[model samples]
Target: MQQSSGWRGSADIWLQAAYENLIESGVDAVRIQPLAKQLKLSRTSFYWFFKDREELLSALLAQWREKNTGNLVKQAERYGESIIESVLNVFDCWLDQDLFDTHFEFAVRSWALQSNDVKAQISEADEIRLAALRSMFLRFGFEGEAADVRARTVYLTQIGYISMKSREDLAIRMKRIPEYVRIFTGKSPEQRDLLRFYARHNYTQEPYEK
Candidate 1:
């Protein structure tokens, strides 16, 4: 007999499989048998972790809350020497998949259309995220109304990216970064800040003008 399988064979595997399945094939594809098959485990193993599909769905939502919502909040609260630096720090959310899961966020938003429970959670997520952005703007010296509008602009622009299913090439997006930062913060970014941004994104060559 095996000494002990321990938690290496535990709930996290099922949760991770369900998360991947949700991203690749939508919520409906996160079934026990399919995931078990993908993991080369028996369907019986799924029950060892999740009680039922509803529990699995709940786990998926919680995962999004922790990763997507949590990431946004962290970025919003990030400190930088200048407002532009702070904004660029927040922009890292878009570039780094580990810091922010756009696929998972979009999937959860789509699922919200069919489930009021999910809709409520997503709505709260939106409010929390937007509030964090607004606070960041406020901290940067923008007054109440201007900060609110800027916050909406930043948040809604990304929401639009998700809704439109935008796939603009990275170079194209990089070229527009200056304009985006200008509009969101109501001030042009410093040349040094722009250069740093490009360097971090590995686009040190002169970006094509758009």
Candidate 2:
């Protein structure tokens, strides 16, 4: 029995499979049998990694917190020449999948609708993200209420996009970024700063209205 449990897939593999299922079909679909069948491993292999389904779900939540909330805070804390640049740094999270997984976030949020515990975690994550953005504004000399409102504006807009599964052409989105920075930070980014931001996203040509 012990050898059977140890014979096959590793914990990461199971967890990854759980993540895929959770994102693709929601959390309820992230079961041991489905994952075992998907991985073509015996059910015993699942126990080698997780004690049960609840444990696996907890791991998924941890990963989400680490990747989504963690990256936003880090980006908000990244060195930027001005508030515009700092706002742009936060914008990178919206564009870059490696920095933030929108689909995964959406999935978890949907799961939250069905679970009180998940809903509480979602609220906690929201607070953490909002606090980070508030600090970013505060660091740039935005005073109290102004900082709070601006932070809410920035974070809520991104969350709205995620929740609604909004899509925009990359070029169109790039063209709007400067205006977004201005709106979010009350200052337009310099041409040089915009150029650097564009280059980071491999947007070579100058943005244009279409």
Identify the leading candidate in terms of lDDT.
2
After aligning candidate 1 to the native by TM-score, how far in Å is the CA of 144 from where it should be? 1.1
Q: Write the per-residue lDDT of candidate 2 for residues 20-100, one digit (tens) a residue.
A: 998889988999998888999999778867788998899899999999999999999999879988888988999899999
Candidate 1 regions with alpha-carbon error over 4 angstroms:
1-8, 207-210
- lDDT, candidate 2, residue 56? 87
Go through the candidates in order and give the clash count of each: 0, 0
Q: Give all candidates' CA lDDT scores.
A: 0.84, 0.89
What does the lDDT read for residue 145 in candidate 2? Answer: 98
Q: How many backbone clashes does candidate 2 have?
A: 0
RMSD list, candidates in order: 3.2, 2.8
Model 2 pairs whose backbones collide: none
**Candidate 2 ranges with C-alpha deviation above 4 Å:** 1-7, 207-210
Model 2 lDDT-worst window of ten: 1-10
